[model samples]
Target chain A: MSTLTPTVPAKPARGLRSTEGKAPRAQRESPFARVSAMIVMGVFTLYFLVPIWWLLVAASKNRSQFNSTNPLWFADFSLFENMGNLIAYRDGVYLKWMLNSAVYAGGGALVGTIIAGMCGYALAKYNFPGRELIFNVVLGGVLVPATALALPLFLIFSQISLTNTFWSVFLPSLVSPFGVYLARIYASASVPDELIEAARLDGAGELRTFFTVSVRMMVPALVTVFLFQFVAIWNNFFLPLIMLRDETLFPVTLGLYAWNSQVNQIPVLRDYVLIGALLSIIPLIIIFLLLQRFWRNGLSAGSVK
Target chain B: MQIKKRAAAVALLTAATVVLTGCASGSTTSGGDAAACEPSEGKVDLTFTTWIPGMEDVAAVWNEENPDVQVKVQTGPNGNGGTYQNFFNQLKAGNAPDLGQIEYDALPNFRVQDGLMDLAACEGVLDAKADFVDWTWGQVNFGEEDAVYAVPQDAGPMAMFYRADLFAANNIAIPTTWEEFAVAAEAVRATGGYITNFSQSDINQFAGFVWQAGGSWFENDGENWTIDLASPESVKVADYWQDLIDRDLVSTNPPWTDEWNNAYNTGSNWTWNSAAWGANSIASGAPDTSGNWSVALSPQWAAGDNAAGNWGGSSTAVFKGSKHPYEAAQFALWLNTSDEALTMLNKSANLYPAAKSGLELPALKEGVEFYGGQAIYDVFAEASDHVSPDFIWGPTMTQVYNDTSDGFKGAVTGNGTLTDALTSAQQSTIDALEAQSIPVNK
Candidate 1:
């Protein structure tokens, strides 16, 4: 612990020097290579951002303006009015869906992170039988897609009489194999064996040592795990589509999809769908911007070690 | 000892699976029995699923009036989009809602699946049959003696919605016959516009044309089914549309898309030969083009003919597993036949009621400002009266529509003619019926 404390202060100077040394090398590269890289990045950035820009512009227009006006530019800034209509539509059902999404994604990610942390911690520290086999199985789980599991999950949920309930979606979302994999790798790399021995020598229990010391060091990795699971569960569509029947129980993704499908029958819903889609992504953007520092640290931690 | 305990737990799980399977199979068979239509002993709470906008308000009105029979409304996507698939899954899970909005063409599918309750035994169901239009009643009855599968909610009688301002400006006359319509199509093309946009995915609109040509696509005797999608009248209708597409007089933009809406809003399309409900579609889809449209009778096959066709209409049916069939039947009847409910539905969703008295509602009599202040419902009223009552829908209309839509898309891309599409769709429809164990004449 004393050795780690001194290195933490020295690490920043080393990082600064490394970047300072590379600055001249970057300038010495050929201008054509730099120009080509910039061009490629600029084209890809435009390709990705153009649709979002269109959505923002369309969300500000009314139904008539949407059809007659330019699609890529703003006609009138009715975004606040559209937001008011979206919130007040159908007795504020949009707010209810938003609350449901918060519960499903927020709650699912929190519990999932804890479970994956514990499972990964055990795999890294314990010398028990079948530890390698268990990790192998989780690796296999990471390879399987969520869509393939949805039908089987629905069948099991129906047999147990849990379909159409919150648990049907939340329960399946709680299992994040990628989170487990990340936690295991980080736990092995960052959690020191000497610290565990010292804590044990001080008469602390294994669980207490883990909760107090290991979890503190694993913060960056846990935050990374939480955000990944958060985005995955937030954008999930198929599971909730099949599990839930009531509109009030639907997450925002499913609710927006339902409204979009009805635009043909009810044309005014088209604007609502566009505005709802724009609002639904705000949380994801906010989350990424908020936890960006921790995510970056988590990604580079294993490489640094 | 660990092995013994694990074996015991596995045995218990196997037993539970067997019991659940038994219960699931048992419920499905009992769901089909019509003898379970007795009224419940206490207050009933029924769930009714539909896609109609503002249906919650209608149900709220009923809830205020009838405390003993309360309805919980659930809104979803339109029937063919996703709601029907949900209904099937819910039925299999034994938790389907008591009442659902089913289109007239889809009612046959529900009936053949044994998913609908025969409402004939419920109170006032048989006596209330006279309140609805004859064809709508026939749609629910399916020529059966003592069976009423659903209560007809709305009817979609077809007519022409034209841009009166555009026609007058182009010095072209409103077409009254098919031949005149084709000639006007040429004129509209010459003026850098299309007569109308041909919908490649919405096959129901094409079926309306065939219906106006006095063609029947399917006929079901008590024992078996007959498929005739390529009849002479149908082929004639198909060939007529083929010529228009070949000449590039009509655009083939997909329906309900932003491009399709923009074409109408910009006056690039001059007419839409759609059902009565299309008035709202145009009004909302092309809000800038309001007050310039007018409704007329659908173009006739011959001069001075008084025939119309039906397109999209729906019924409210009580599912077979509902425990409160009597309460569900009462609510369904009131929602469709009552004057206040019908008027509210028309105002909210622009639904054309299936009841005969609904046509006389003051709301239906007034001129719509979007349609140049014309009383367009008058045209639809006449069209409703002239629709042939003998047009029958088959038990697999969804499958038939899907097959025909795929073929139509191919035809639009110049892979085949419309008649060829129909001929191939006819064969696939027969094959689908056979796969479902339905006896079909090849």
Candidate 2:
């Protein structure tokens, strides 16, 4: 595990230099290849970023200007006004959706990560009968899509009279098999047996050793798991769509979708949907940027092993 | 580790079994028998789900006045987007809202599924029948004896919204008949503008066209459903539009899209034949053209004819399992029939109320600034009066709309004619009805 730590920092720098160094060689070998690569990357970058740019521009325009003015450019700087209207519309329901999204994503991810972490650590540290069977099941769970489970989950929740409650959506979100798989892989690769034995030799309980000693070593993995689960839960629409009928409990994704559908009836909601969509993705971008270093490290760590 | 693995495995296995069993046992509960519509004892709380804009404010008014029967309003997407699907799921789960906003075309679907309460037994429900327009009243009853399934909420009487300035500037006379409308389309195209943008996805609009032509797409004779999607009258209407599309006299932009809005806003499209609610659609979609628009009666198939089509309208229905049907019916009647509530709804959602008295509201009389100071609702009122009361909706309107819309999209792209779309859609509608176990005439 100690030997693994040094390679994490050194590998990124070497990787960065290797990419940078390839640029010169690429130019020297064939300008056409270099130019083509740059062109391809440029096209992909535009393909990915242009819709976001259009959303930003559209969110800044009033309803009149949305169709009358340039679609890809701003006019009259009505972003604040549009945002105020969106916030004030339906008595600040947009903000409620934003808050609900935070609770579902933030709360769901944190709790889901811990459960996944503990379960993964146990599988990695323990020599258990049926461990492979359990891991295989977890792997199978990862293969099952969330959309496929939404209807059955609705039925199960409905049987207990939990449909339309916050718990109906939150409870289903907690079981992230992908997070469990990631945690196990990272735990086995990074958390050494010697360190656990050493911690145990000091009379530490298994839980204490796992939390204090092993968890410190698993920061990158846990952060990756948290961010993954957060984004997944944040973007989840079908589960909440079926599980909850209460608009106040809706996540921003479902809320925006509802508004988008009503634009024909409430045409002004078009502007609100545009601005809401732009605002919805801001938190995702912020979270990604904040946890990017750990995410990158976690990805590299898994790949190297 | 062995204990933890066993624990995790047990948890996973249990969850999987529960889900599997849940799926296997997800048999739908048959709708309850007609309940005695009795007032609940003590204070009653009810849930009403609707997608209407400003419905919260309207419900708040109701809640303030009637504390004993407080309503919790949940707003979502329009019916057919996701809300209808949610309603069906909630109905299966036995947790549907006490009342839900169901469109007229969709009411039969819910009725066939046995999801609605027979409000005729409710206090004052049948008595309130005189409050709504005749057609709207008939819509709620589905021509059934002593069974009012819903209270009509709004009506969408069809009319033509045109650019007065564009028509004037080009020295083109506004068309009053279908033949003249065709000629006007040619003239408008000569001026480098489409007479109207034909919607490729809004099969409901196409249905409205057929409705105005004195054609009925569905008829239920109390035993079997009859689907006449390609009846001669319907084919005549379709061929007329098909000619406009073929000759490029109309732009085939998909409705509710930016391109469609741009066509209206930029005056590349000169007219739209839409429902009463479409006034707001034009005002919001083409703000730049606000002061230049005017409303006229929808063009006649024969000159001097007064037939008008109806498009979108909805009803407030008490679900089958609602405990407070008595209170639900009272609220629904008040919401639809009362002048105060109707005016509020008109201002909030541009709702053309199904109540006959709603046509005479002060708001309906005033000249709207957006439509060149025209008293547009006057036109809609006349259209509402002319809307045929016999246009029966089938039990699978969603399926019909979807199948027809897909075919219409193909027609617009030259894959087929509009009549061909109607023909295929006719077969599809029958198939859908038969698949749903609803008896259908071939």
lDDT (10s digit) by residue, model 2, range A188-235? 999999999999999999989988999999999999999989999999
Local distance difference test values of all predictions, in order: 0.86, 0.87
**What is the DockQ (computed on Cα atoms) for candidate 2?**
0.53
Worst 10 residues of 2 chain B by lDDT: B24-33
lDDT of 1 by residue, A1-305 (tens): 12123334444654665666655554444445545755776677788889999999999998789988999999989999999999999899999998999899999999999999988888998899999999999999999999878766877788898987889999999999988888999999889999999999999999999999999999999999999899999999988877877778989998888888767656778989999999999998899989988887887774565
Which residue ranges in model 1 land beyond 4 Å of their true spot?
Answer: A1-40, A296-305, B1-32
Candidate 2 lDDT, B216-296, residue by residue in tens: 898876556789999998999999999999999999998888899999999999999999998998999999887999999
Per-residue CA lDDT of candidate 1, range B100-176, in tens?
A: 99999988777666678888778889888889887888889777646688999999899999999999998999999
How many pairs collide in each candidate, listed in order? 0, 0
**Candidate 1 chain A, poorest ten consecutive residues by summed lDDT:** A1-10
Question: Any runs in candidate 2 off by more than 4 Å, and if so which?
Answer: A1-35, A303-305, B1-35
Q: Please report the TM-score between candidate 1 and the true structure.
A: 0.88
